[model samples]
Structures are given as structure tokens and as C-alpha cells.
Target: MSDEPERQIKALTGALMEVYETLRLICLHLPVPIQLPRGPEYDLNTLVPAVSRLIEIIGDQPMREDEQSLVWGSALNWTAAAKLYSRYLLTGGDFVSRLELELLIQTAGEGLIIYLDGPDSTTQE
Candidate 1:
């Protein structure tokens, strides 16, 4: 949301149009054959949209227990996990919120995508 171009982040779910575009720019500038921390696995095609959807869904609350678990395992009771805003509440909040944030970050890292060399270089997602 910040107006400063250097610090704006639109990587989370349902990222603003600007943010998504920024992500593409970042990927384009990365060293050819983007390498992730976990592995070299990368896909430019579905990476952006997948990460966006995951963040949007996880950040939105009142989600079913199953949904939360799918996002990330629930270490504690989902019923008492509190609201989504609670992620910053209670002095950094509980495990669930923290877990969601961690998972989101991990997904961002997993977003290593290929840079298209030409029109025929990239595949449809």
C-alpha cells in the first residue's frame, strides 16, 4: 500500500494489479533459470496466480477447519485460532496466524519462475 516504489509489496493473495506486475518484473530480472532455496524447480506460467490465490485465501478468515489445514497444518485448535486480523494481535499472535504468514512467505519463495526468452519459450499455465 505504500506509495514508495522501492518498498511496495503485492506478492500476497489477490495482489493488487500493480503488485502482480511488479512480481513479474522481479522474476524477469532474476538470474536466468531461477533457482529456489529448496530446489531449482520453477515455473513462470502458474507461479504468480497460484501464490496470489493461496495468500488471498489464507489471509481471508472464517475459513473452515479443513481449508485452514490445507493451507497449513493446524498445530492448535482452529476454533480458537482467532480472526485473520488477529495475526498481528495478542503481541504477534498464536501459532496459526504465524503459520499462515510463514506459509505465504514460503510460497513466495516457491514462486521461482522461468524467464521467457521469446514468444515460444513460455508455456501456457
Candidate 2:
């Protein structure tokens, strides 16, 4: 792995974590007046920007041969999740859309773990 790929992966991972945390907060703060650690301002403004950075990273980098499948699949999954999340917000948090968004984010997170930890680690688990 070259330094550039490593850099991109690290950046991607950070962006993914941000988006994931934002979504988690959105879900948690929906039904209750709970005080989240990050306060009560986690909304589309925050999510969309983080997601935009994530998409940019995914789009700008070419998938390396070593982890091509995982990267490609993750890219698709993240993009879908972002769109679904937008729909989820627009529809006033539909349960089905939320569920679907969760699934996509979960799958994308797993793919990211595989990419970061090395593909062989998947079999070891």
C-alpha cells in the first residue's frame, strides 16, 4: 500500500466516523429530548457536509487492486445510505427508510473495517 492510499483511507475512515456519529445522534434525538454529548444540533447541515466530504474521498480515489471489491462496494453503500438519509429526513423520519439506512450504513461500516484491517482478517473472525 502506498502512502497516498493510506492517507485516503485514514481520511475516509474519519469522515465515515463523523457521518456515522451524526446519524446515530439523529436517530437517538428523534423521539426524546435527550442530551447528547455533541449537544442537540446534529442535523442535515452537519450530516450533509460530512457526507459530501466522504463522497468526495470515494470519488476522487481510484480503488486499489488490493482492496478493490471492498472499496467499490463501500463506496456504493455509503452513497446509497446518504441518499436514503436525505429521504429519511425529508419524509419526517419514516421507520422503513430509517431501517434501510441503518442497514446500508452497517454494511458500509463492515466493508470499511475489512478494508482497514486487511481482507484476510475477514476470514479470521
Candidate 3:
């Protein structure tokens, strides 16, 4: 039981980390700075497309119906990751800090909450 939750958490964390790494790689290839937002006006216009392409590259095989969900889900996960990454960079945290990793994992959990709750549900709001 406890192990089940732990394993699930680990799996989700790994997925988020993978997404983060992929986003980093994609960012490296791009020309923009893609800095973290400073306030509530944080727009995801650039990140959404980059993350969508990354998810497609990473999970587009076999063409399953679930892959569609995965693509969009990864986009959402990357959006959250960008938020935390920006915070880390702005605060002068180390590039690979454990705190940043933990924030990415937590953001992934929030993405899961959004997925499970559906687009219209206000449970997380």
C-alpha cells in the first residue's frame, strides 16, 4: 500500500524530470532566453509549442489514443516546470538544485491533479 504510493510518486517524478530535460534540450536549440515570468502575467506561448514538439518526439510512437493525452499532458507539465525553473533562476539557485527538482516534482503532481479533475472541474481552483 505505502509502497504503491511511493512507486507511483517515483514514476510521476521521473516522468516530470524527463519532460524537464527534454524542455531544456529544446530550449538549447532555440534562440530566445525563455526566462521565467516575474508576476501573474506569465504567458506560455513559446513554451507550449516547444513542449508539445518535445512530447511528440518522446511519446508519439505507436500512435495510441492515449498518446494524444500524453502530448497535451506533457505540455502542461512543462508549463509548470518552466514556472519553477524561472523561480530558481531568478532566485540565483543552482542549476541542478535539489530544491528545483522537488519543485518540478510538485508541479507535476499539480498537473496530474488538473488531468484527473478535467478541464471544467474547479476542484484545484
Candidate 3: residue 37 Cα off by (Å): 19
Specify the poorest-scoring 10-residue window by lDDT in model 3.
33-42
Candidate 1's displacement at residue 10, Å, is 20
Candidate 2 has a TM-score of 0.50
Q: What is the per-residue lDDT of model 3 for residues 24-123, given as tens digits with 9 covering 90 to 100?
A: 5433433332322232333445554555565555443444344335334645656666565555445654535545556665665554454445445433
Candidate 3 lDDT: 0.49
What's the ranking of the predictions by lDDT, best on top? Answer: 2, 3, 1
Q: Clashing residue pairs, candidate 1?
A: 13-56
Question: What are the clashing pairs of model 2?
Answer: none
lDDT of 2: 0.55
Stretches of candidate 3 exceeding 4 Å from the true structure:
1-45, 48-63, 94-125
Each prediction's Cα RMSD? 15.8, 15.9, 13.6
Which structure is stronger by TM-score: 1 or 2? 2
User: Candidate 3 at residue 108, lDDT?
Assistant: 51
After superposition, candidate 2 runs with Cα above 4 Å error: 1-66, 122-125
Go through the candidates in order and give each one's C-alpha lDDT: 0.34, 0.55, 0.49
**Candidate 1, 1-125: lDDT as tens digits:** 33532222223222322233434444334333222112134332344334444344443445444333333222111112223323334354455655564454444323322222332333465
Q: How many residue pairs clash in each candidate?
A: 1, 0, 0
